[model samples]
Target chain A: GAGVSQSPSNKVTEKGKDVELRCDPISGHTALYWYRQSLGQGLEFLIYFQGNSAPDKSGLPSDRFSAERTGGSVSTLTIQRTQQEDSAVYLCASSLPLRDRGRAFFGQGTRLTVV
Target chain B: SQQGEEDPQALSIQEGENATMNCSYKTSINNLQWYRQNSGRGLVHLILIRSNEREKHSGRLRVTLDTSKKSSSLLITASRAADTASYFCATADSNTGNQFYFGTGTSLTVIP
Candidate 1:
């Protein structure tokens, strides 16, 4: 079975620019989540989608960060007017609904570098 | 915000030795999961223990959960060089809908 995958495994962008990171979750996964991991830091929750309904967005650092999941599938995270502080590894994960707890599969992640 | 913290930022041991990592969370959780990441790649799920369960074993891996203390431990028996990587424990709070809070992780080096 194909696993969750992300695009642009590595990206380098100048500050003040915008970046879009994409995630393709495994087939049939009803839940998708986006997280950010800074150097030597723990995984920070960004947003989560369960079957097109997002119940949590409080983790987004600021207005510049937003994410959308369409058709209960793929998700995209957009960082508008990116800043140097926004640089980090953006991770995507999916699971087989809440019933299959603690078994979320993750993608390779997009390493965004804001220069 | 992070809810879990792993002790001993790093650990190094011989390939045949046992490796143990501990994690403590601040809130009640439905389940505690352990993940392994090599380099900076996406993490791979290693094991998961529900809050009600006290202990579990898979192959050479052993996971124990103590709800009273809000902590968990992962023990890898007879580890191998390929086990060298970072291990993280994530807690899924029951109040939250499938949102997992992760720890800072422990970097383990298995010297062959």
Candidate 2:
């Protein structure tokens, strides 16, 4: 892909339902990140996946929020038992290996609205 | 808690004026990069400055980093209405350089 790609640009799910957002990073990139942003706010780090390393999950707001990256290329962010507070834009980014000091390229985010 | 915080949450300026935004982080960083977002969607990478480098320039953008203070600033010269957008700063931790944290963005409105 020419840039990072995300699926289901907009999602509106009932509260208590589960929704999954997907991200496909650029080929050969070794790092991926997920972030959530509320209306008019800065991005909140959600999770980070580095090549073959344990993901940094410190930023997940709660146990209901989880994400996984498969084959070092695609990632899925799952929000279980979603609440109204879960409404926000989910952004995914990918970068080159850390050794290369690469800047992140972002995808057109998924806007999730839990009603 | 590792997130960086940008100052002046919102700014408004006239075209041709310089716009400056500051960011401060808590820990040491291997490098810092700036991004611009429009319409609250995807962000575009603007500039990156390694920890060892004090300053870098790209077109009308100038970035400066001070490791000792764990802070960085982005300056846009001769701004235009098209430059209006939210700007964010991200840092890669020096320890692992894998954890990338973004700051609350500074929204700049360039009035023509």
Per-residue lDDT over B1-112 for candidate 2, one digit per residue giving the tens place of the 0 to 100 score: 8889998899999999999999999888889999999999999999999999999999999999998999999999999999999999999888877767889999999999
- Candidate 2 per-residue lDDT, tens place, A54-82, comes to 99898899999999999888999999999
Candidate 1 residue-wise lDDT at B110: 99
* lDDT of candidate 1 at residue B77, scale 0 to 100: 99
Model 2 stretches with alpha carbons more than 4 Å out: none
Top candidate by TM-score: 2
CAPRI tier for the interface of model 2:
medium
Model 1 residue A23 lDDT score: 96
DockQ of each: 0.74, 0.79
